[model samples]
Target: MSQARPDHLTWRHRLVALAMGLSLLVLVVRMVELQVVNHERYIEQAADTRASGAATLTAPRGAILDATGYPLAISIDTWDIYIDRYVWAQDPDAASGAAIALAGMLGLDADQLMASGTSDDRGDILVQRRLPYERGAAIEEADLWGIRSLPSSIRSYPEGDLAGPLIGYVGLDNEGLWGVESDFDHLLRGQPGWVLHERDAVGRPIAFGQHAERAPEPGGEVQLTIDRFIQDIVERHLREALLEYQSSSGSILVMDPYTGAILAMASMPAVDLSAVGTDGAPEGEALAGSVRNRALTDLYEPGSVFKTITTAAALDLGLVNAESGYEDTGVAEVGGYAIRNWDFQAYGWVTVREYLQRSLNTGSVWLSQLIGAENFYDYVERFGFGEPTHIGLSGEAEGMIRTPEDQDWYPVDLATNSYGQGMAATPLQVLTAINSFANGGLLMRPYIVSRVVTNDEVRSYEPVEVRRVVSPATARTMANLMRDVVEGVEWHGARVDGYTVAGKTGTTIVSIPTGYDFDTTIASFAGFLPYERPAVSVLVKIDQPGGDVNLGGQVAAPVFAGVAADIMEYLDIPPSEQLVAGQ
Candidate 1:
């Protein structure tokens, strides 16, 4: 009986050993499958568990500088406060106290912050943006467990509302939104990088752990042709003129005729990019007119300012000379449409020079008849009309022009267009076309950005000629005629003391859903200083002025004189009295 019991115990021990061996074999197979067959999958899962990949490093945006290295739009270091709800949930009592303390410092409601800190559904929350460095440092020194502050920046316009439409603004993600900012966004916005950081159990960045980081590349700087002093002077006079004339809006542009560099582009009702409504939109009157770069974007009937095109065509086509004579009855009949002078009066038998001096519509139609429709359209196209200037600006509108080939063609269109009507043009387009005379009949491509400075190189923009619209002699003749107009008694208001300036004025009836509004007019004046040398060309426009002072000579001409005088003084341009007398 003792031998049988020993044998039974031995068999039971052997069965237990066999079962343990089978269990060990199964465990080894499962370990091999996980470690070798699906190694990459498990590795990625472990990495994801340690790091959420939620954080990103933002590169600094470039600075926008003025002609003399003055900062117009700049980026200043700022901080953003964020909250991690998981850490706060772990210590409700302590987090509540911290929330109250933080709320006091941040000027936030304590109860609301406390509730936000206690919530677990929200993983992370942005508490505040654009917090001052000093204030954020104070919060960090307090050693709040759940709160973290990240380095960021906000755009600052030091000049404050000056050249607002041109400098434009950026979004929260550091993306450019308008004007030059939008036009040159890719160059201004630098390349962003990434960092792979491990987190703790409570979703906090671990100081000592497996991590990787790639540094971001900073953006380059953009230097514009805009002169800060000139911009300020232009805006000051434009603001004063807007108030004095009680006009709804106004714009002024000062350009270098030789280099095609824009010295000053100012628009009234300017907005500060740093100032916005709570809903993240531009507020008030600035919202309506200031958001658009009016000099390039908005279009209107150019009125007499366009007569420069007609006069240039007439002179270039050899259809008339300054000594040519025409009989002006104050009215012109074309295709059953009667076009009359602005004053609705008669001035009979005026020379070609007197035709422009008196701004006779009948004389302009007569010149158009001599040039004919085909030749007229040819000259207009050659002058860069009815087309975009491609001036490296966003929201540029190519003003409308109806050719003889279009279905809307009529003979009266020629007469009206000849006298600067029946068509539309942007202020920049008008200025660009008229610039041909100032630039010796060479149409130069107007540019705002003068240069760009990067880490490696400095790039400069040179004068680009679109085409030669007329002969140099013709341009000189046209300029001489314009100089005669400025020196004449009719344009005496446009003259600056001690200097002879040449320009033209236009007061067009504002177009509406109907035919036109005679009550509202767009008064504009375009002129260049030191007529003989021709340095700067100034264009001024006042929209919908109040009272009886609605004429271009009455409203915009004086403003041009004021702006021209200031710019000439700033540029140290010597007056040319001898040159004026010679002309």
Candidate 2:
């Protein structure tokens, strides 16, 4: 005791003690501030450090199903991969290894993968993501120290190019950008859920502290009017027709005549939505190819397709009977707008059947004149032209009937419009008008969506008649005359043997800007099966079909015949063998 008291502490010892005391106190204060003052914040950070990971937990998007529940688009389980840049930096050469590993997992070029940008702050790199589980597991088993995989989802189209345009794709952030996906994004994209927990100094979850997770709820499924078999038929024939006609672009639409439910819709140059990000093409180019929905968004002067409406107008207004006659010196001048046949050769005299059979522009003009502009315009409006179909698709064109809206309706406008010129409409618009004729008299709004289904219940979209656009009597006579346009003697017989095919052919010259020497044409044909109680109405439009023989009767009508005949046979609807000999 005496020795200890006598040997007092040195100055250095006292100074060291004081420094230790201050450091301990400071740490205590900091701990209290972090653990109590901002308890939730620090706890969350602690959880993240120990067990949890900051990541985008992608919510599963809704499935797009055909009418019979065949999936057009579906989301499948995938792996979300992350990389610890700090760990990779440990071995400088490992960065290349990391890229090589990811590229192998993703079936991508190793060089391209190695060069992708990374977060400069050494944050966890969202490296390869949405990998199929097996591929991700393989990468993980390789013990790529810098890499980790978490659960995620990616949209997959199993049918490969089937209804690709209809069911659009989503991004990693689960954003809908086009087609039905974008149109019904809110309903399709479900709410994302999160996890709350504590972590250590390093960003790893605590593994047990207040571990809370709210699993994501899947979105409702949308059932479309598309029949997978029917869609396949439409696609095949459209491509075949495009090849046969050597056209720049083609559109084929098949819809239920009475209900307006679109059975099959196909457009050339359609994009596979799932291929947007997963393919070799640069991201920008892949996206550019799918910017527009050709069937609904694009509009063209519906050459002969417009004639169906004119034919309906003629019959409805009693301007011409089924056997009405006309004189076709191969040309007819009306209201100072000279209309001529594509051949520029006049038949001294022809019946209405021969006029339409040959797709004579003059004959259509004469019919419109006989019906009078007011009456003709009324029938056109009744056909649902010049207005949005409101089919729940994004970016629908209302189409154009310039003369109807203009008070100063020039004779040229009226005359050109009657024969499908001076008028612009989309393929969908043409389908709707023709469907009315196919349905006998009633006009129904064309719809692609057939049902909305959740896991527990299904909401079916029943067909509702929007309006009776024409009298049954008017519809019958129009169909009769249109029957002639298909089977009539004056033009190419665009009819399937054993089927009572009734259709109209149209050839519209694209409006050339002043001083342009070249002439461009849009040829179209619209028809229905059996002439009455039709199961489907098929409309085929070929744009810029430049050839020595470029009439709708030659180009588009034949396409209608091919598609409609196949569809009828598929449905087991026996051919009526109905004939129309001369337009």
Candidate 3:
């Protein structure tokens, strides 16, 4: 107005000033919002852009130790190799040369490596997994482009094939798969950790860059009740017998009868656990019977091992005493089915104790009638048959028993079941049931793991009594009767030199689809040593042994003797005064 400028020029000047003021105001508002109101959001975004990579730290699996603290299964640090496809794509000639060189070092095919490293779609590709220290070190020395390695672990068994099936195995994902591994997987597998590191714009980790990491927690250790020394002895003798008998297969279990702690358990035709991979199959051995622990899973007629259960039931019910006399016509008829003893010969009149010593079928049938079918079934159930032991192992089977409530139950069922026929039981079940006598009529829950050592504390497992099957007096009387069996002339093969062993021998015809196969039989023996104290219980079983020497006394009893003799000497058990004086 002072200069008297034109009206259009004045309007243009005013408009320019207004636009400048608006721009300043907007800039100030934006600065305040970014620096104060939205400060945390922006900062987080910036940090996200700076963090280029993350890595996982695998935790070491716990060691499986024996009672003496010897490691059965352990994890060793290793390396895993990887290839960056984007880096290799930069140069064709260099990529080809690197692929060939890597293949030669890793014993891999050249074409496979080239294909793996030349993929533009995939960022990082696996070149190899779980390589040993020496092999990984050799590859690292090459230091080729696009090649890298990280730390890892591989499972190893120091004592190969010893407790192989029981210790179980791990999978490629560093997870437990079978046996104790599968049973206590959460306790054995430790917590995994992770790391976040800053990287430059080129996707390479910046030198001295900011990083954050969480340290991994190693898994707790597992202490088993297995005794390596005793296990070794059992395996040695079992292997010899397996080959000598020319039998289909066999198994032996040595347990602390009072505690139900398995000291040594061996299965013949064993799979080399060290040779097995993450796939859970053995490479060299036949896979049919190798993978499964037959003692827990397989069921057979049990033959004479079932007789002890019947004897204990009779004595507990007061249906028969050791001195009770019965007339044996060599055969007993039930439901029109004529059953005879193993010898198929009549001994005329014999005491009830002679029934167990001689393993008489007619005498057991007669006793079963005196106890009645209903009472007989109740006694069998009390002995823990027809159910799984819940031994913390997978694939445990419950044996079959026909009771009075079942539609198929008949009078003949009573006679056959009394003598261990027409019903099925697993080796574990037979062993556990017979163990009641040794445990002072107390049935205990069997367990393999004895202790667990964690970073925080250590826990020791105690013997758990499940139930009492008989009175203490009755148990003592039954023990005495079994002692006579071991001392009898027919069972002289089973007698230990210094120990008053009490056991029963069984030989029964194999049942087939058509009927009992008279030519084939399963031989078995169950006994406990140091008769007075009863430190250990042993069960030896041979399946389908060829030739005429297939009797339990001939094939299975000697194994019991050999194993017991070694165990007594190793344990430093003193011989009885009776034994010393006799010697």
**Top candidate (lDDT):** 1
Ranking of models by lDDT: 1, 3, 2
**Model 3 local distance difference test score:** 0.82
Task: Tell me the deviation in Å of residue 76 in model 3.
Answer: 0.7
Which digits, one per residue and each the tens of the lDDT, describe model 1 over residues 1-583?
A: 4554444557778899999999999999889988998865565566556555344556777899999998998877777787777778778887888898899889999899878777663357779997887898888888787787766677778888778889888878888777788788887877764455577665765678666555667677999999999999999999999999999788999999887789999876777665654566666654756678899988888988777789889888887898998878888888998888888888888888888887778878988999999999999899888899989998889989999999989999999999789898888988888888888999889999988877778999988998899999999988888888788755467899878888888899998987999789999999898987887999999999898799898999999999999988898877887665666
Q: Relative to the true structure, how large is the alpha-carbon lDDT of every model?
A: 0.84, 0.74, 0.82
Task: Rank by TM-score, highest first.
Answer: 1, 3, 2
Worst 10 residues of 3 by lDDT: 46-55
Among all windows of 10 consecutive residues in model 1, the one with the lowest summed lDDT is: 1-10
> Per-residue lDDT of 1-583 in model 3, one digit per residue for the tens?
3886566757778899999999999999999999999975665555556544555567888999998999998999787888867668777678888898889888889898888788663356788888997888878888877787766788888898887777888888888877788788888889865555666676666689867666668888999999999999888988888788888788888899988998988887876775675375655447536757778888888877777788788888887788997998998989999998888899988997888888898888888888898888888888788998877778889999898899979889999999898898888888888788887898888888999988888988988888898877677877788888888655477899878888888887888999989898888889987887788899888888987699898999998999999999998877755545655
| Deviating ranges (above 4 Å) for candidate 1 | 1-53, 91-114, 138-143, 199-209, 279-288, 455-457, 578-583
